[model samples]
Target: MGRGAGAEGSWPKTARAALSGAGGRGDGGGWDVTVGGFWCTARPSGAPPLPERGWQLRVSAAPAAGEAVLSAVVRVLAADPCGFRFAAGQECLSVLDSGTDEPGSTGAFITVHPADDAQFQRLAAELDRATAGLPGPVLPADRPYRAGSRVHYRYGAFAPPAEPGDDGEHRPVPRRPGGERGEDARGRSYRTPGRGRLPFGASGAEAVTAAGATAGATAGPGTAAGSGAAAAAARRRRGGALPAGRYAVTAVVRQCAQGGVFLGREASGGAEVVVKQARAHPAAGRAGADARDALRHEAALLARLAGQGVAPRAVELIEQEDSVFLVQERIAGQPLDGWVAARLRRDDGPGVDWAEAGPVAHGLLDLVERVHAQRLVLRGLSPGNVMVRPDGTLRLVGLGLAVETGRPAGPAGTPGYRAPEHGPGRLAPARSRVADPAVDLYALGGLLFLLATGHDPLLPEDLPRARPVPERLGRWLALAARTGGTARRLAPVVLGLRAEQPRQRWGTARVRAALREDSPGRTDATRPGGNPGTASRSDAAGPSAVPPRPRLGGPRRRPAPAPPAVRRSPSDTTGVSGA
Candidate 1:
């Protein structure tokens, strides 16, 4: 049969009957079975059948044991001899409370989509082998199988291939008697509960209430039907918002081409949460990159960083129609830029208090260092991406652009804060293809400069020219002219981190050491006469103490090369510009 044979109106009666049986409505199709200690549900993709990639197998495991089973399944599939091309979609599975009010256990659902019938059989065989010694019943074909909902992590493509002459427009599916199924904006089919039916595993008073609501809605106008219609209209007005029952969106935090960030409250406990949504195929800079993949990558990274307290805690990932939602604990804080701007507005001096910014700078360094230690680089670190909590600690947000070390450095991160080596500047021609932590260091320098002087280091003209400074600070004096007394002392250290060349940039270790030198209780021991409290006669003269400067680009004598066994110390105390 041709690929388009499975189009909506063209589906054969046999196929429709088979799909109806697989819907898990007790039509004598099949029942859930145990495989390797996990509940397995095998069903049709509900997509128009292509020559290949038409079957889905869902595996459910107890919350405590989900990770282990998921890993085992991945390993087994990776080593499959049949070269089964498949992907796993992950989600949290919850069973509603029964009449007895007994607590139910939460679990994970792994939905696997196989390329074809041959691969599907191979996958089943391999799974059996992987869980051979485990204590569970073997897979059987007699029971009804149902599909899953609210997918969180998608490892590979599960949608059918686009057919020739396809317009990518959504076409509604024919609804069944008790439930509804339809295509989303992106032409992906999804099933949702109808008025009379509750979700799978729902029972007791919940089911009764749902049935009662349905009955009332059908009783005609001037009754409950009028109110039901109003409710349905409200839902349609919500449009692409999250599913209604789980979360109630209160406000929108940010909206971009990629998606929107929403402030919501959980229905279960009324706890505030942040919901970040990613549209199916938003515009992107890199070819083949989409918002879906970025959101999925971020969720995986958040899962890895859980318990570290540096990033927001991931609540759950929900796949609702064409958009994906990532729910996280609401962080109670303001953006770093807003906080700095507020402090600057209140300060009588041109610059902020160094005592306040000093600790913030150290906190940023520590957070970035910990991220790098895990072999990840935060390519999007900027004043906007960092948050200052109520307790005066820092947390890194906007981690969607982060890439692992040694991977190709794509066009990611905010413009001014991005490193020259990673951007499309003259230096990019010779830039390394793989990403590294140096990019983050460059942004760190810019952030610190802003914190100290209330100006961006990238734009030298923004630096204040009225504030007088000692000439000994070198090339950085112009940049630090407006900084506070204590902040001026760290100007060289900040400039060193913002060097144009990656090789010329200061590493985290050197930057930390410089901050320690100017830390509280530390004395300037490098001054002449070993005096910690007094300046030399030359320093007392201020700007006049500086000697006439040599012109740039003039012929200059080169220093002799150092001996092979001897190392030369840096002329600049910051160790960033001396070489």
Candidate 2:
């Protein structure tokens, strides 16, 4: 295919040559086009001469493959090439009769100015064919892409756009008559099951209210306030909002710039699930990959750790239009922070009782060991990402920020839980730092401190501060008074783990040893700083220490000769008292 400067702009020579059929099509084909980036943006109305031409494609390739696609499109339509304007990487494509071109600040793309409806249809069809096999869906040239089956919005908000002359009251979009179903890209049929349809354009809050009214009407008066909460979860076995109509969104758990996390239920089964939506090009970047790539990474990680009981199990990944959704098992627990706060509230004391906190601390330690054993660093290990079950077991959630050991660490993670080395902080530059297990260990220390005292180390008055500082006598004394020796006993361990320098932080082996020694079952001699002499006295006074006495008048048999003691190494503590 020959190339020329079309309406968009001068095409890149490299991109033109790459698509000139010089490289064959197929794996070995010389399809060596380097795509700098690809995205879509809204086009201004009126200038395009057609209302349907409201969006345009942005493609940045060294050889300018976008122009080649546009060229093919024009040839197929038998349209004039001047009607189109192309922008190579970071350049704007000028609009006809417009004062200025759309800014190319967000990257390069091709803009088409179709003169009529016939040209618009031809353009959309050709562009879709040209980019059909790309990573994401063929966008801009096609109609707006909806994420899930029933919901119109990509983030699973039930609000549909209000119809004209509706007086601003939110209303559900009417489904086609006959309860017709539609198929997704995967050719699976799906439809909304219930009579109540979601309002596609309503505000998120309104959409949430509609969903609650649909599902939470049966909840009692006591639960009326929390009816919209995720706790009122149930599964549907049929049609719903998600692809294949397999899951229906009940509540949106969290929403952020990246995307929203929804509490959904299985359409076929009654199990509750969590659906995490990832937009195509999230505002926030993750190691250069888009939110979709990050969600895929998280799904793979969850699959790898499945059945370990430390992380949520991956269910399935659904790709709809320009968004990706990850459906995972909904953990039946509360956030670690809330769990701690609830215990603190119930107790009359300033901090949680050590009896209640110790088990949680140990469970967290075990979880860390399991994750480290897999060579995965829980980069975002904050209390908010941890879930504590009623049975006292712990599970880690939100593994999107996790990275493999030795991978380049990015400026992602909770501020208070992040370590110094993984920084764009005073100690290190923001970039070029590699992931290390010590980062998680550092967070673990802060987490333990939170459990012990119900106060985050990030607080100004906490003993083990998130930032590095010289150990202050006053801070230690304050911690002792608050935790009543529970946190005091673990102060050295926490200090070692939270050391500003990664190398000075305690390793897994040392932490395990310290925790084992301080276990509740250990005797005085085995406890740290316990008096060794008191061990024999405690043992003699204990029920297990005294020998059994003859019960009857019958002559008591002489005590059997004691067995010979076997010498053992220091490491062999089996059957030995306080070895």
Candidate 3:
């Protein structure tokens, strides 16, 4: 929490996957790749090869009862730096990392078209061959790596074991156990390969082999050397069951508004997982959010990370191809919100529940600290984004929006603590329209306020959910309101950070001081009742309202209003890709 921390550095020189984020990558030049279960990198005609732009390859298949994590690869091209794009799904699903998701980087996904499955097999074979001899990436279980660091496969260009080790073992990769580096798990845009300064100490090629980053993994034989259409077919049909590894997944778990979440398992093997089709809900996509796609992305991410987090690898995603299927590790425990809700239901005043719940809170905060120390920011932090199990161990799920640097960010916060800045471009407006550590804290504080107060801070009218703090918890709630729009006068610091003028937000140090504030040894309850007649929190006396975030995917016909510019680097680290 002090000056010992590393200074925030400049953006990566190339389009590397540094902590910046995933959307609107560096001067992408408007080129796009359609229909992906795989992404490939290529250079323009007669070029030296893309220096930073990277290509991705993953193989996934959903399951009957649970999903599997399979082998995936990230290939950086030295050829023309082209961009490949796709969407995770229409709606926002739960991301393990909460708010710190990389914007344009799609989660790992594998969707093999039935007709093309055959071709994918051969292509998979070739890739396996290529990667089999290549050096594996240098990353340990706990050691973090840059976003695009290549993980060698034993096929095609990514093959392994060009020279067998004297012991005949694919070199053993170093494992960091519980140590975390480079923005805690899923938060930062790590562009440096997992080679440098290790929290566990291993480094370089030794780190790669020491950690088993690419040892033992092999691709199949008899593959398509190359024939464009045939190659594409093979790539599309590579969707297969996820391979067993450090991670496991639930059969696609189904959550219905009517019946709650029902775990669907395979009828035969307990180890097998399954996914059920959506019941034609407007939100569910036909070809869009299909199960295969969901499982594909989940599996892809797991394989790419080698089962680093809670999301499981994909086994098989689509049955009907029209429905969306999601396969994941089937994490034990309830949603953090649900966990808190049950505790609150007991209604015992700050006694056993708090004592019992301490670990969960600590674990969540611990993760936040580690992530932020790595300079990773999960802008979107909410009870809904956290999970707590019976054992009290917590894993922050969701990484779709995590980013390394904070930019064009403001408050776009959840209800109660929804600061004035969260809307479109409220904070330093020049860069990306995303959240950072301060924003993450604002949300975390809001969640904490709810826990302490036993009321959802955001009333039905104030937010999307039913989280208003209980009257008894008013004093703590007031402290969390430091984000200007929501705080009471006693905790004026929160207001300073949340001040209408973006300039008032200042540096990360300034933001942190205001957000990490303490209660004044206790105070009066300002909790509102019916007709409490408080002015709407939105009536911030600083800057009026800024425009909302750009429409996620509306037609480009009309331009939206941009927010006021306090001015900072718009996440300068767009896809400064690194091959």
Best by TM-score: 2
- Better-scoring candidate (TM-score), 2 or 3: 2
Regions of model 2 farther than 4 Å from truth? 1-240, 283-286, 345-348, 425-432, 459-477, 480-483, 518-579
Q: What's the true lDDT of residue 525 in model 2?
A: 26
True-structure Cα RMSD, model 2: 19.3
Which stretches of candidate 3 lie above 4 Å from their native place? 1-269, 272-326, 345-347, 350-353, 373-376, 403-414, 417-419, 424-428, 431-435, 459-579
User: How would the candidate models be sorted by TM-score, starting from the highest?
Assistant: 2, 1, 3
For candidate 2, lDDT tens digit of each residue in 235-279? Answer: 121113354457766665444324456776787887888788765
Winner by lDDT between candidate 3 and candidate 1: 1
Model 1, position 544: C-alpha lDDT score: 15
Scanning candidate 2 in windows of ten residues, the lowest lDDT window is 538-547
Global CA lDDT of candidate 2, please?
Answer: 0.48
Q: All candidates: CA RMSD in angstroms?
A: 18.4, 19.3, 22.8
Model 1: weakest 10-residue lDDT segment is: 96-105
Least accurate 10 contiguous residues by lDDT in model 3? 570-579
